[model samples]
Structures are given as C-alpha cells and as structure tokens.
Target: MAVTLRTAILDDIAPVGHLHHRSRRSAYQGMVPDAALDTYGADAAARWWVERWSHERDTHRLTVAEHQGRLIGFTYVGPHEDGEPATGELYAIHVDPGHQGRGVGRALIRDALDTMRERRCRRAVLWVYAANHRARDFYEAGGWRPDGVGRDGWLGPVPTPQLRYALDLTVAAAEPATPAAAQG
Candidate 1:
C-alpha cells in the first residue's frame, strides 16, 4: 500500500492525463452534469498539461504518485500571476477512482507542498467545485480553509459555484504540529 512520490517527467504526460480525466469524470459525475464532465476529455487535459509543462519559463511543478511503476495520482503547483511571490496555486490534485483512499493523494500533496516550499511560496491556493463535498472535505482535512465561493458561470458545465481554499505555509510552519512533515 506504499506509494512513491516524485517529480513527474514528460513521459508521465499520458498517464497523468488519463488519471485526471478518469478521476474527474468519476468524482464529478453526481456533482456535475454528465455533459460537463464529458466536455473535459483526456485529449483536452493532455493538451493543457503539455502547454504548461513544456513551457521553459514556467515554474510549475508536477508531483506524481506511483505504485508498482504505475501512476495513480498527481498534483501540480505553479506560480499565480495574480498573487504575491509567496503565493502558488495547486492547479490539480487527482487520484485514480479505483485508487482513492489509499494515501496516494496525501503523498502527491506532500510532494507538491515540498516543491512549493522550495519555490519560496508562502501560501498555497486551489479551487474546488462547491457541490463536490468529498473534495471539500479532503482539502479541509489537509488544513485548507474556505476563503470564498463564487459562480464560474462561463467555466462550468453545471454553472455551479466554486469554493476557494487558501493555506498559509508560513503560519503552518510556525504551528507546533506540521501535518506535511508528519504525513511524510
């Protein structure tokens, strides 16, 4: 049941996209309409990822979770143009539907956080669908607090609201207990 976390390479592109598309569709099926999820196909996800990851000027980091040489989950981190230098956004955190609840997410996240720290990022941010209670609970349990919620009408198949979560790594480090370190 052990999962290894490491920096994702170009060779990981396909599997990463596959995991994202599958997990997103499966996880968002009930919360999001089938048509919306269908709009986000594996090809589109792969194209988006390739554009970002292939950019030399990009400071984005992709952390992948692997077990028995197969990718099961991944987390992507990168600088946010609209935020401070210490601010980074977790673009995506996904685990295969069949591999959920087996600690792959935690490993992927831990690796992403470590990369953020190396980038001198003081805070991390992400957006999750408001209707996806499972994702909300997962992020909340990982110490992310809801900072805001808004409708991304142009961005959703369901036109549902999205909740924003923010976590201050500086404050997190000052605390007596650092979950990332313990989890690692």
Candidate 2:
C-alpha cells in the first residue's frame, strides 16, 4: 500500500498517542525500565498530545503517515527551545511497530524536514538515547550527526544518557522537497 503524509488533526490524538506508547515500549525496552515503560500508557500520551496540540498548534507542526485509512507513523517539529531563531527541532517521531522496517518513518522524517525548511529553519536537532543504536543509525542515515554533546536524563525513574544529533538544514532545504521512499 502507498503511504500518504498529511498534517495531523485533533482527531488523530488517540491513535498518535497509541503509536507513541507502543513505539517507546518497543524501542526503549532495554534502555528504560519495564515499570517506567508501563507507566507511559496510551491515556497519558493522548492527554499530553492533546495539551500540546491545543497550546502550540500554531508553532508546532505535527504530520502523520497513513496507509489506506490508518495512521502508521507520525513526526513532530517545532522551534528548538534551547536554540537560536533559525534552529528547529525534530521533537519526536514514532512508527507503529507493525509498520516498522517499512518506509513510514523515513517519509515522516522527510515531511518534517520539508516543513522545517518551509519555515526558514537553518538547522535541526534531536536527542536520542545513547544506547539506542537503531535510532542513532536512522538519524545518521538521514544526514544527522552527533554534536559530541550528551547529558544525563531521566526516562521515568531510570537515569539514562542522551546524545544530541544535529543537521544542517540549509543544505537540506536546498534539496527537493520530495520524500524518499526508503526503509527506516
């Protein structure tokens, strides 16, 4: 099935939340404690998304990838809170486990990059768990590089190390906006 990308609406909150919960659970299984993962339930995620979407809809861009009629992946982009005016952040990206290894994640990331470029962002940054090589590889393949910066963070109750990844959007923006159909 062909995947389509579109801006997320209020109606997508639940499914996006569900995907977020599932993705985190699967991706952070060994990194985060099982109890902490259990605490990140669909309800909490849905409420968080609802609040964020309601409060920052204008400043943040939420895009989802759908196959047929079901949303299988999503990405969030916004101004980096700790960055300069021209720096954007790839806040989050989640793909349903069922859709993993497909092109959904790559498409969602491309859409977010295009959106950031449209916003005149010159750079983008994201943070990933230092232990998550899978995620690190994905970001690296997408042209993001670690800035040699890391920090201690809490994923629920467990403290973990996180690495910051940076991308030069000025170069990415110069490229065509078409999303590549590559596996992520």
Candidate 3:
C-alpha cells in the first residue's frame, strides 16, 4: 500500500498526538532515563502535543502520513532557532510504533526536504538525541551528518546529549537520479 503525505489540519490533532505519544514512549523507552519518563507520563505528553499541534502555525509546519486511511506518522519543520543562513530546521519526526519500518518516515523526510527547498531554504537541519543510537543511525543513513553539538535533552529531565545534522539541498539537487533505464 502506498503511504500518502499531506499538510496536517485542525482535525488531525487527536490522532497525531496519539501517534506521537505512543511512538515516543516506545521508541525512547530504554534510551531515556526512567525517572524522566515516569514523571512525564504519556497522557501529559499527549496533552502537551495536542496544544502544540492545535496552535503552532506561527513558527512551524506539520505534515502527516496515512496508509490505508490510518494515520501512521508526522513531521514538523520550521525556521532554525540559531538563525543560520539558508537553513530550516526539522523540529519533529515520529512514526507510530506499529507502522514503523514501512517507509513512512522516509516519505515524511523526503516531503519535508522538498517543502523546505521550495520555501527557498538552502539546507535542512535537526538535532537527534545522542543516546538514541537507533535514531542517530537512521538520520545518518538518510544523509544527515553530525555537527558536533550537544545540548540539554528536549524530552528527558537530564541534560540529554544531542548531535546536530545538516543537509545541503543545493548539493542534493545536483545528485543524479537513478536512470529510468535502470528500472527496465
């Protein structure tokens, strides 16, 4: 089944929040400290997410993925906080635990990059938790490289280490696509 990506609307708040919270809890289970996860329960996280998704257009954009009419994942992007020239930031990317590894994330990322490029963004940037090696590897595999910066964790209570990754869209555009002949 093909996965579809579209701009998130007000009606998507509930399902998007549900997927975000479940995926975060399951994906970050052993990676983040237990204390932090315990303190910020999934319900709280869902509520916070609802609030953000409900009214965050001023500084960010949201995209959702649907497969077989079910919401599977979402990605958010916006202006870079540090104000880097020609850069846009990917604020969040989450796929439902049950729907992961089925190309939903990859689709979301490609759509995000294309959207940012269309917006005149020269590069795409994001931060990944250092301890979440799986996510780090995923980003790296998708052509994101480390920028050697760590900061207070965004989700955990402790100062979670983070590594910045950036992709230059200009260079990406110049890369040759697989020849149509190759598919014959």
Highest-scoring model, TM-score: 2
Q: By lDDT, is 1 or 2 better? A: 2
In model 1, which regions exceed 4 Å deviation?
149-157, 173-184
In candidate 2, stretches whose alpha carbon ends up further than 4 angstroms from where it belongs are 173-184
Top candidate (lDDT) = 2
Colliding pairs, model 1: none
Task: Rate residue 112 of model 1 by lDDT.
Answer: 73
* 1 against 2, candidate with superior TM-score: 2
In order of appearance, the predictions have TM-scores of: 0.85, 0.91, 0.86
* lDDT (10s digit) by residue, model 2, range 64-111: 889989988899889997968898998898888888777677777878
- Would you list the rank order by lDDT, best first? 2, 3, 1
Q: Name the weakest run of 10 consecutive residues (lDDT summed) in model 1.
A: 175-184
* Cα displacement (Å) at residue 61, model 1: 0.2
RMSD of each: 4.2, 3.4, 5.8
